[model samples]
Target: MGWLFLKVLLAGMTFSGLLYPLLDLSISGKTRAPKPNIVIILADDMGWGDLGANWAETKDTTNLDKMASEGMRFVDFHAAASTCSPSRASLLTGRLGLRNGVTHNFAVTSVGGLPLNETTLAEVLQQAGYVTAMIGKWHLGHHGSYHPNFRGFDYYFGIPYSHDMGCTDTPGYNYPPCPACPQSDGLWRNPERDCYTDVALPLYENLNIVEQPVNLSGLARKYLEKAVAFIEQASTSGRPFLLYMGLAHMHVPLSVTPPLENPGSQRPYRASLQEMDSLVGQIKDKVDHMAKENTLLWITGDNGPWAQKCELAGSVGPFFGLWQTHQGGSSAKQTTWEGGHRVPALAYWPGRVPANATSTALLRYCSIPTVELLESMGACRLSAWTITRPSTLLGEPKLVMGARVLSNSTLPLSFSTWKTMLQKLRPYREEAPSTRRCCQRSPGFLQMSFKTLLMTTAPERTTLRTLR
Candidate 1:
């Protein structure tokens, strides 16, 4: 009888798994989610061990832990670039920074913008009949050719760029000496451009601006509401959907809030993070309500915190340059030390991705190509695939960084190789982190650049220019 019961249990599990596609296609009148509806929840500038699941022993992060237990954790996930615009460009294009001419932030300087020819994840999904909508920050571009509408998103609703960008070309939407032109009544203007406020909100429904979002503390609820509506609509229409919800929290002016605003804010060190966790909880509830175990959810950060803000403003936490430097590299100052590039990365899918599967596998953001996703839906064939760094291909006239630099390519180390790299890099590893000891192991293809060290006036600052 016990054996028979075991057999029945196996049969039940098998039946459920197999029934998913048939029921989804037939009764529901919709195609099964192709490789799951991908949701990349990009946090602003959180740390490597900030999540509860990653540092449960010391830190008090609950919601993130629950997520890890139910999904897969990429112990070694990497960002495309160290900053937001370039990093995001790398993600959407599936190419490294240089190829897209956006290796730097677009706010302060004009060094980067998404390329025109590059196909976006939305366009790919749209081709395969997946509804694509961006519900958060759209920092990629602001103009016609470069906007999300042009890139691939069928629907777009989010802030144009960083809230911290210098004041706009026009003030108060119009009036006294509009920077250059009075523009028109159609343009947007916010007085809180340099400060934090819930008023000067930037809101979009589809292509039209419906309202200006205020009180970012409630941004999560807004996204969740939109996501739920989208999922419901997709469920009714019987087509797969891709939802990219980027949150703008744990980043900014750092004001205290209610429990709902910051769930885990009790700890002085990472209060905003706790609030962010609350936002995560709301998202999870919506997913469960939709019963989207077949959906894929990927969460990560935009870039390291404002290093200077961390130092002077008391907003950013411990990450070296989270508040200051354009982007603090993963590990250390100037180089891909792991502090900036190797921050938090998590993926979860119900009834699909193996639960508790903590993958140390070297995963790059560029790997999520639109074609691959479409292929899963039997909608497209692999015409071609190239993994070149975009920033290098289009921009940088001199291209002096990588070509003339001539740095040794260091592969990610295992238990043994890491020890060797550590021994080789010992002089600079002294001030790594106050908590965990640096592991002797790294990703398989982990490489370090000598340019940072070689350029610094002294060998003491050799670690300044580590590679990403």
Candidate 2:
């Protein structure tokens, strides 16, 4: 297995001090104080250039730009995988697609999901007494036990998969525009063009279908309302919470509200970007108002933009992947090129993460230090040998963080360390029969190699290599 290692340089006080309260309590065998809340906002198919802070040309993400100024922005952050299901699986499990058994997009008819046995971050937090909620685009799986509600989320609201995967009452703008669902649907097919017209996109609230063929235009507002409500309720209940919002914005079939002045003047993608930014701003405002002091707000994209969508797709900024593009095919989204997985990331914790700080260290969504930080805060109990303290990177701005990617022949060396525990939790299988196809090794899985990234900052540079 080959893993991409990125060095993370966090500019702030010693991270240990930030969690001293919880660590001290754990060591002294005392009841821990209130734990800080955690909110992870994941954008669907959003490109690295979508954030105005990351790309000067992107003016739509005003709220996100302000967030970068108020927090630490990572210049070399990446998603674990280049696609949806695998990326999301990695985020929640802190494991790559190989370990989590999700390496591709799941269909609406997928009989399985992220595997019922895999322990999710939500489950760990829930067990630690945190109220966990997931709002928007639960693409892991929608079948029976694989649903979000069964995956340890106390509340779930969103679509089963990507918005364009099914027909909706009002199909949003696209490069090749998609039509609305037929009023009386009896296997409505569009053979001339590539689009889903058979199944109706269903809006889910927990296990129940709130609305079949969801109104794409109004979905973003609904997500915002539900997110705010959950935050307020969890805050009032006096419990720390975890809100994992998987936004549908920046994805295909862009459902953006038209501007009042000129409805058709702005490009649909830019308009949608603005709408997404506004939604993010609202959510951030709610967090600031209710739990600004003790909450950590982290935002990043699941993967790169879907380049096939052309004008409707987001921007990849300067990660053009000339080497790959020169050959043939797209280097975005489904590919393992830098443009496919390298995403923009921002971390905000009012008094913790330094404001306006930029970290050049490479970091991936799958093995973020936040998981270790959460563990230190009594979120979950992992084996002592496997625990990496957040304090390790206190003064080391160029420290390399390593993780293993799935390969065809060999399992990760670290997998042996986790094997026993994983087996104890659930029977270890080489691959699940239902999702075996989806669990194939990543395309980039090959022998390890050394690759150095030259930092733009003067006199400070780091060398990175692929881990195997």
Candidate 3:
């Protein structure tokens, strides 16, 4: 009887494994997620090892650990670039910084920023009738044409760039003194620009200067409060909303609540991580209470940890490198190494994405375009059948090969290879199947530009550019 029971249990497991997709599709029945809300909580410079779910030895980041256990975690995830501006540009546009012309962070004095023409994720969702709000850091662009308000978000409450930028001469902050960094104590008016100008860090609320040199202590909590308020406002307004919460903790000059300072971790960075974890938990709890079934939540980091800060920088997980440089051609932060670009990605949607399941499938920040495309195809459904059901060509072998090329091939390691893959797949989305097949069949026929190869810089460590 025991042997028979064991056999029956094995059979049941096998049956469920095979039948799960069919059962799900049958129950869902070609239905789209009506009025589904989207929320993305992005942590700045938070490492994979910082979460208790990913690593056992972390200082009990309970909120993020709970998030991973409740959602689907991607073990092999990556940011589009290693730096703030480029990674963020990739996140919004579904393209690389090289393609988007945002290769580095914008300088304090210079007005450079992400190009205005590139489409952002917020823009796409907003076009699909979703109310959008961006709370926290907006590092992609700070200048006139490239600001968040102009890009897509309906409401923006965040700093123009990294908090570390525009460093002040204030005590306890050891930033390099800059000659042209607007040195002043109180608010000063730039009459020609018609905006408040100051040496201190400026915080903006929809193009207006709200605070300069925002108090570092309890800043993360303030951001969380703003996000919760925005969620409440958007929910009551009778419109689906997209809340992009780009967290500023764990970046630099880390601060934490007094309660979090001693009980869990004596280190400031650890305390900051603890605070961030609780903040995420609060937001997720709000979502669960309001719209668990109708909301899709994603939590991830912009890039790897800042290794230069030693004990204060956090861990890099099992990847590679410590600080800016490591042996074996591996590096962190500013370089193209896996340690630099790879970050955590977790997605949660009750009754949609499989709970507690992990997908090792490689994902890029650039695939956000596919999300936009899926949303544009009508009612959005978060399942495998959504793409396959709408388009008959996804199952074809040639298209599968194209998909495999994008997923499995080493071609995407370089920017040129990524361009080749995109050039081939763009047709698949455009309904030009013949063109896609032609492109896929002769994938190797595409010539690699010598200049592109020459332009590619080998990953190496240099002087630390920014604290972030």
- Residue lDDT tens for model 2, 272-323: 8889999999999999999998788888888899988888888887655544
Show the lowest summed lDDT stretch of 10 residues, model 1: 384-393
Number of backbone collisions per candidate, in order?
A: 43, 3, 2
What do the candidate models score in CA lDDT, each in turn?
Answer: 0.51, 0.70, 0.61
- Tens-digit lDDT track of model 1 for 124-178: 6677667788877778876567777777787777776764442322122111112
Give candidate 3's whole-model lDDT: 0.61
Candidate 3 RMSD to the real structure: 17.4
The list of candidate 2 runs beyond 4 A from truth reads 1-31, 258-264, 364-468
User: Could you give candidate 3's per-residue lDDT for residues 140-174 as a string of tens digits?
Assistant: 76788788898889999988877766432221111
Model 3, stretches more than 4 Å misplaced? Answer: 1-33, 168-198, 259-265, 322-330, 364-468
The TM-score-based order of candidates, best leading, equals: 2, 3, 1
**All-Cα superposition RMSD per candidate:** 15.6, 15.5, 17.4
For lDDT, the strongest prediction is: 2
Judged by lDDT against the true structure, how good is candidate 2? 0.70
Predicted structure 1, TM vs. truth: 0.62
